[model samples]
Target: MTCGRPMFPGSTTEDQLHLIFKVIGTPTDDTWPGIIYSEEFRGYNFPHYRPDPLINHAPRLDAEGLSLLAEFLQVGPTAQHFLMVAISEAVFESFGAAVQRLSDLSSLFEVSGISLHKNPGLRSSATLTGRSRQGR
Candidate 1:
């Protein structure tokens, strides 16, 4: 959403660490589950911080778009959506007429039981050679 440089940047590892503390703050069980159990987590040494709201990062987005963006930006592994389903949902949510046209097109092929996946390669070489002879 930000499309900006890293919130935490530094010349050295420790400097970056300090920047992370300043920007993202310390990760807790609630903010980042299982972070405390990670091998790299050091206890009580770094300063704590709370992140700014998502709205602050994407000031230009409208309320409806922001809500959808929030759903896609959710944390944790299980929060993820299937790529195709997410795209379809976004398209339908954002463009009603286009979604309807796509649905109509899909119904045209549904009766044939043939899928686009069945043809996976380029046009046959015979087709290419035939085209070359047509101009002769």
Candidate 2:
């Protein structure tokens, strides 16, 4: 996607996180609600970083693409699911339909006893299964 240019090409986990923070900004409790609960992150004081606009990092992306990329880069399952619904609606119907589609999908998932937040792997499995069934 980056044309072989790795975005945050750091050699170690900490270094990678720092690079990500430099661009995406440091995660806050609001942005990353459960980060403080992680054993690896607990008590570690990460330096504050203000978000650098994506254009500063990926100059090739246009405004619309950057907007979509920002949504795709969101931190949690709920955000990611919303991004997926938004993208699907944008592609298959009108963007105005996204809210309704999201509601519909949420209700469908609830009825099916599928929780994307609890088992993210099911999303991958379902996607793969759908692709296979489509003979794609």
Worst 10 residues of 2 by lDDT: 124-133
At residue 128, candidate 1 shows an lDDT of: 16
- The clash count of every prediction, one per candidate, is 1, 0
Q: Name the 10 consecutive residues with the lowest summed lDDT in model 1.
A: 124-133
lDDT of each: 0.47, 0.59
Writing each residue's lDDT as its tens digit, candidate 1 over 18-97 gives 66555445667776688767766663356666655556655555787566655654444444444335546642333333
| Regions of candidate 1 where Cα sits further than 4 Å from its true position | 1-26, 41-46, 81-85, 91-136
| Per-residue lDDT of model 2, residues 10-84, tens digit only | 998888888888888888787888875777875556799898999887666678768876776676446867765
Please give each candidate's TM-score: 0.39, 0.57
Q: Model 2: residues >4 Å from true position, as ranges?
A: 86-136
Measured with C-alpha atoms, the lDDT of residue 6 in candidate 2 is 68
Question: How many angstroms is residue 12 displaced in model 1 relative to the true structure, after the best TM-score fit?
Answer: 8.8
